[model samples]
Target: MDNQTKQTVSQIPLLTTKAGPRDGDKWIERMKEEYTSLIKYVEINKKSDNDWFNIESNQMGTRWQGKCWYIYNFKKYEFDFEFDMPITYPETAPEIAIPELENKTEKMYRGGKICLTVHFKPLWARNVPHFGIAHALALGLAPWLAAEVPHLVENNMIKDK
Candidate 1:
């Protein structure tokens, strides 16, 4: 067997004493990485008509909330999402919610939590080490909206707002 070098992780300054030493470091790194990815996602897709979306992120203690807007079929749909890094994040997955959209789809819980599909869940699990809220929104919610909302409108599933 070949010997591998150990990678050192720095302690996160923002973490409180309640946060365990090494685990907090990992969580902070993952959070920052995901947040950066989300920003890059918006920048890269800013000009693309079909895939264009805007995001505003706010750091709230350990959680970050993102306000996202996208245009589909010439109509604008806005969403407020909360991204939380649980102690088990990247291993179990992050907690995300869209509290404003209600009675929208079977995939959504009554409390505004999105129930990701089997397809995306596996993909997320495989890439959790690097995946973040941005990935969830871009790869998960974006496509879900593109495919589901049209049907919701056509079949009269969505309520008039």
Candidate 2:
């Protein structure tokens, strides 16, 4: 019916793939409904061109240092990515690695590929909805990085204690 509806309909199939056999189809329908609501929220909250957030579009991805959830030097490590969702909303996780730290940590797995434990898991164990990517990145992955590898912040060493 509308562009937003079309996008939500399209995302249903992508979300379905992430579900298991018993609940996949039902989950897809539910996600499609939820995505429709999310689309409406985004549309209603669309910023004016003169708004500060909209005016700063050019600086969207640059590094900021006030309060980092997680910090790693992308220069030292390069990543290759693939995703099933649109570029604006990537559904799949990217792979990441650095040569020196390849074998020293559990976070990246032994093969040097970034794992997606937080990505696919439910947000709350109770009846609440999933927290999506931003929350997962902030709450789960960021804390995991800080706790599992404190040396990354202290000395940039994989094994420093």
Q: Give the number of the best model, judged by TM-score.
A: 1
Q: How close is candidate 2 to the true structure, as a TM-score?
A: 0.31
* Clash count, predicted structure 1: 0
TM-score of 1: 0.69
List TM-scores for all candidates, in order: 0.69, 0.31
**Candidate 1 least-lDDT 10 residues:** 4-13
Can you write out model 1's per-residue Cα lDDT over 10-103, one digit (the tens) per residue? 1111211222113656545555565566655655454333344454544433565665555656676666777555666555555567777667
- Each model's lDDT comes to 0.55, 0.34
Which one wins on lDDT?
Answer: 1
